[model samples]
Target: MKQPEIIFILRGATGAEHLALEGAVNLEARLSDPDRRRALVAGFYGFHADAEYCLAPWLEPVEGLDFAARRRLPRIGADLVALGGKPAPSRERPTVTSLGYALGLFYVLEGSSLGGRVIHKQLSHTDVDQRGLSFFDPYGDQTGAQWRAFIAVLDREHAAGRADSKEIVAGALDGFRLARMWLTE
Candidate 1:
C-alpha cells in the first residue's frame, strides 16, 4: 500500500515548522515571565480564533469531531484576563475552502497541542499556571489519546485517498508561515 500523504507531509513540513518555531515566540523566555506569557497566549489565541473561524464551515462536517473541544480561544482569553491583559483583536485570516485544505490547517492546530504538552510541563512548575493553562494543556491527561485519535483519522483519510496531497501540504505550509509571522509581530 502507498504511504499516506500525511506521512509525506510530516516528513516534508518538519523543516519548515522548525524554522517557524525557532523564529516564532521564545517559548522558554515567555514561560518564565508572566507578562510575556500573557502576550504569547493572547497572540496565539488571536491567530487561532481567526484561523478556526475561517475553517469552521469546512471542519464541522467531519464526524466525531468537536470544534469546541479543539478550540482554545476561551482558555487563552481567560489566561490573558488572569494576567491582567485583554484579548487582542483577531489577526489576519487564512482562506480555506475544501475539506482537505481545512484538515491541513487542523493538522497544524492539533499538532500544536502535541507540542503544547511540553510547554505545559514547563509551565506547571510556575505560579503562572494558577492563572490558566487551558490553551497549553487543553486536553490535560487526555492529550496523548486525543492526538492518537486525530492521527488515526488523518491516516485513514490518507489511506482512503480522501484528500489531495497538494492542497493539504499547501494548507499546512500556509498555516506554519502565517503563525510564525504572527508570533514575530
Candidate 2:
C-alpha cells in the first residue's frame, strides 16, 4: 500500500522514537521541579544547537524552509539563563550533509514540536516551564500552521520527485538516535 511521505517517514522511525523516549523519561521527571527544569532545558539546548548547526547550511537554500526562523537555540539559551543555568554546549558532531539528508533530519526535529505542545500544556502553569517552553513550541498558537506548511513542502517535494523516502527515513532515525545520546549523555 502507498502512503504519504510523512507517514512513510513516521513508520520508518518507530524504533528510533522508542529509543529516544528512553531518554525522555529523565526529562519528564525533571519537569516537576524548577531547578531540574533548568538542567533539562540546558540539556535540550545543547542537543538542538548541535543539530541545527549541522543542518542549517544544507537547509538554508530551500525556499519556504528557513532554518533560522525555525531555530530554538537562541530562545533555549535565554531560557537557560533565566533558569539560572548556562546554556549547555553541544558535544555531538554532524551526522548528515546535503539537502536531502537535512530534510530527513528535519522531519524528526520538526515533528518534535507536536509532542512539545503536549508537554507544554502539562507544564504551562509552572513558573519555570512558562518561561522555558519556548523551545518546545516556539510558534505558540501558530504551531499547527507551521507544521502544516512543513508537510505541504514535503508533499510538494515528493510530488516533484525530489524527495527520497529512504534518505529521509535514515535522517530521522539517525536524528532520533543522536538526540537520545545527547540528552542522556
Candidate 3:
C-alpha cells in the first residue's frame, strides 16, 4: 500500500494529544477572563519563543520555505505585552535536531493557526478589548493560503526524503505535549 501523506500521518498520530491539549487550553473559558487570557498569551510566548529558537537553525536550509516569516515569537510577545504581561526569558529548549524534525514541530505550530482563527472569531463577539488578540488572527485573510503553502513545503520535504514519517509524527506529538505543559502551567 502507498504510504499516507505526512500531514495525515501526523494528524492521526497526534489526535489524542491534540484533544488533551485542547482540554487543557479551555480557550472559551480562558478568553473570557482577563487574567487567564494574559496567562495564556504569556504561556504562548514561552513556548513559541523557545520552539522558534530551536527550530530556526534546522529549518534554515529548507528550500522554498521562508522560516523567518513563520516566526510567531514577536507576535506572541507583542500580545503578551499588550495584555500587561512581560515575556519571560526562554526556559526549555525543545530538541529539534534535524530538518525533518523541525518540519514536524513546525507542523504543530502552524496548524494552531487554524483553530486560532476560530478563537479569534469567537473573541470578536465578546466584550473583551481586542488589543491583545492579534496573535490569534495573525494571518488576517491569508490563513488558508499560508497553511496550504506550509503543507506544500512539508510534502516536498517528505518526497525529497529529507523528512521521515516517523520522525514527523514524533515531533508533532512532542509539540503537543510541550504545548500542553507550557500552556497549562
Candidate 4:
C-alpha cells in the first residue's frame, strides 16, 4: 500500500481514482443495510461505465465488444458504457456510493483476458479472494486484515507494468473517468 503512494503521482492507479473507490466501498459498508449496500455497488459500476474520462471516442476499436466476454460483469459493462452516453445515476437504493470502489475495481474487473486476467491471477496468488468479484464493493473482501495483502498485490502489479502499452492503459483510463463523474455529480 505504501509503495503505490509514490506511483500515484505518476498515474491514476493511486490518485483520485483510487481514493474515490476506497471512499465508496467504505461508505457502502457503513450503510444501514447489507442488501442496499450491494445495490449501491452495482450503481457505482453503472455510473463508472459512463464517465467522461472514459473518452468513449478513444475506444472506437472495441466499442461494441466486451473487455472480457467470458466474465459476466465486463461483458455487460461494455454496452452500458456506449459512445456519447453519460451516467444516469438512476438507482433506488437508500444510499449511493461516489463510485470509488467501482473505479478501483476497474483495474481488474473492467477488461478482457489480457489485462484483467493479470490482476485476477494476482488476486489468486495472494489468496485473499477466490470469487474475482473484487474488493471494489463493500460486499466483498474489501475490508479487514486480509485486504492489506490484496492491495499489496495490486501495488506490485501496477508497479511492474504501470504503462506497458497504450491501448491497455487507455481502457483503464475510461473506468476512472467514469468514476469521477459518478461521485462528484
Candidate topping lDDT: 3
RMSD of each: 2.6, 2.9, 2.4, 12.0
Which segments of model 4 are wrong by more than 4 Å? 1-14, 27-32, 44-66, 74-174, 180-185
Point out where model 2 deviates above 4 Å. 1-3, 15-23, 125-129
Estimated TM-score per prediction? Answer: 0.87, 0.85, 0.93, 0.33
**Mind giving the per-residue lDDT tens digits that candidate 2 earns over 1-185?**
23466666556565658555655648666776787777778878877888888888777777787778988788888878878888765677667755556777787778788878877877766554476656787888888888887777766775676766666667777777767766662
Location of the lowest summed lDDT over 10 successive residues in candidate 4: 93-102
Per-residue error (Å), model 1, residue 8: 3.5
Q: Tens-digit lDDT track for model 3 on 57-117?
A: 9886677778888888899888888889987677777887677788888988998998888
Q: What residue pairs clash in candidate 4, if any at all? A: 20-100, 21-100, 21-101, 51-178, 54-174, 67-111, 67-112
Q: Residue 16 lDDT in model 4?
A: 56
Give the alpha-carbon lDDT of every model: 0.74, 0.73, 0.84, 0.38
Total backbone collisions for each predicted model: 0, 0, 0, 7
Location of the lowest summed lDDT over 10 successive residues in candidate 3: 1-10
lDDT of 1 at 159: 62
- Tell me how far the alpha carbon of residue 91 in candidate 2 is from the true structure, in angstroms, after superposition: 1.4
State which candidate has the highest TM-score: 3
Q: Which pairs clash in the backbone of model 1?
A: none
Candidate 2 C-alpha RMSD relative to the actual structure: 2.9
